[model samples]
Target: MKQRSSPSAMTDFYSAAALVTGGGTGIGRATSLALVREGVRSITISYATSAAEAERTAKELDSLGATVLVVRADVRSTGDITAMFDLAANKFGRLDILINNAGTTRYVDLKDLDGLTDEIWDLTLDTNLRGLFKCCRAAALMLKKSGGAIVNVASIAGLRGVGSSIAYSVSKAGVIQLTRVLAVALAPEVRVNCVVPGMVLTNWIERGGGGISTEEEAFRVAAATPLERVALAEDVADVILGLVRSKLVTGEEIVIDGGKGLTY
Candidate 1:
């Protein structure tokens, strides 16, 4: 059942459960909190290295009278992805939503062909594209059981060839196409959709040293956006939450870039 209304207005997720990848920070963190606030029955947040942040988020969700499970896993590894889903299924019994939000990138200049080496390409493709495919495959059966939904966090870069690096942009393009394919692959039982966020304010850019000139690049993008503002993680999260609950939505890639994509 999809809540076609405001996220805060919907409170019918009493028996629903969710698994959020990269749930320690940014859009993932915001989505996890939104799920809990919407009265989801259980939530399992998977983090790659942000153990402390995950623990802290878990504590906050737990304090809100929500069941929270934090798992350490990397999407790049199939074994870790399997284990993460296993833990969620074991703890929550069934999953109603899967948020594939974990991703990785580097800050190599687009013109530096040498910088886009095999290692860099593999790192970006493995984590952002292949890893996400594996996660969706692993969760397919479980989600089928509950007629669950999937919301993948992609980027506006997937739509345009502008992002951190050439490899990163290419991988996200794959993510967009992957979402479309999986939606058809898992139809009638589960829904698959993606969110393409533009220039959101998050530490991911700083951590990855994305090809941006400064952390304030988001504000610059915002200034050019028709909305006259950059996106926040919560803004992306809100759209994701809606996608997760939408009964009629599948294979849809909604851009949450606040019209930034139009200019670029």
Candidate 2:
């Protein structure tokens, strides 16, 4: 193979400032680590309330010689999201990437209107759909000036009907639509995309979410997927990192569902 030019060699080094929401655990945590390995200088990890885990992650990244800021910002709040990104811009001097990964979920039986409750439905939509809106609005402002990349952590639930809960499925479906809309709206200035993952082996799932259970049956149901197994956080994170650099990839949904969305 012939030697590559200096420009190609500097691609990884060029990743200076990046921000990832929900970075306290799972896919967010994996992506945060991956960014550091790719030479991202400073990163802001945003979480709703997981302060201890966030601080621990910050310390770990700092120990690796990377500047990691653990910021407490609920994606559901427009004010909080906007302020957090503003703080990130000031801290790093330049914003290069944004990963909209923070989300909320619950399980519900749509048939039982009384049991589902209006509050539950609203909360689900608020965080998964409205929260994404708030973060994208703020991130858009930063990326327009600097020309950055955004990867929304959507889920297979968004693409199909299976998920932790009924409200979760609906909220995620909205997220998929939001991703496409923003990808077009942001256009040439900022590259926006989304990732849809299937049964990822995360703490949230193993511990049982609202509508989903951590039973042998659930695992069997997921394992029966096309890939015959589930995915790890790192597996999905690798895909997110690749999508972040593509100048041509926008208004696209990259499915990382272990072929679960595909034929058996």
Candidate 3:
């Protein structure tokens, strides 16, 4: 009798090397750790301004017996992106996973069109959308060689059209579409997918200038959420890991909002 092999048996990470952008903190940090736990032995994590945190995460990965490379690369800068990918290629000789998790947003009130200034809009679009595209382009050739996977971290705001600001929502929406396009563009060699998380309880809010300001406000959001809670960074990381390991799935967006979008 012939038996089917397990998906885990088919997609082994023990020999895989991965790169995670924004891998210093929040969801990026969580995803990097998850990959190490899944037996990925070599990983490169890139950070724009989270050098201290990136160092901390590198130490953690080292402690887990994974060879870790930490690079300071701002995705907005083409030179930085190119240098980061070049370093990863030099160190690992191959890359099997790419996680596009670096992004930025500002907390402008939805109706405050004037508050969504050009600077804020430009920064959000450049970092979240344009920068993500550049990372994909730089990794495309290596990913093709390794038959790798890409998991982009987007937001449910893109689908629901509500988030920190108009620019942020729009940028994430771009991420979703970009994932779909890249899935086809990289087909038969690489798979690309996206995870759309909602109301994740991370420092992102504080760092984004505090849209969900208070603990009480956060609790209210959890109460309003259909699942009676908000997502943790680890929750989103799990989804991203799943997408990375899915051998046959691509061009898909998995929403991880604890069913929050159902109400909307």
In model 3, where is the ten-residue run with the lowest total lDDT?
3-12
Model 3 agreement with the true structure over 176-234: per-residue lDDT tens digits: 99999999999878889999998888877666654547465669888988879888889
Question: lDDT by residue for model 1 over 139-243, one digit each (tens)?
Answer: 998888888889998998888868889999998889889999999998777889999998888886666554555447866777788999888899998999889
Per-residue alpha-carbon lDDT of model 2 for 147-185, expressed as tens digits?
A: 778899888888786776778888888888888889889
Candidate 1, overall lDDT?
0.86
lDDT (Cα) of model 2:
0.80
TM-score of each: 0.92, 0.89, 0.93
Model 3, total clashes? 0
Residue 74's lDDT within candidate 1 is: 88
Pairs of colliding residues, candidate 2: 107-211
Estimate every model's Cα lDDT from 0 to 1. 0.86, 0.80, 0.91
Off by over 4 Å in 3: 1-11, 208-214
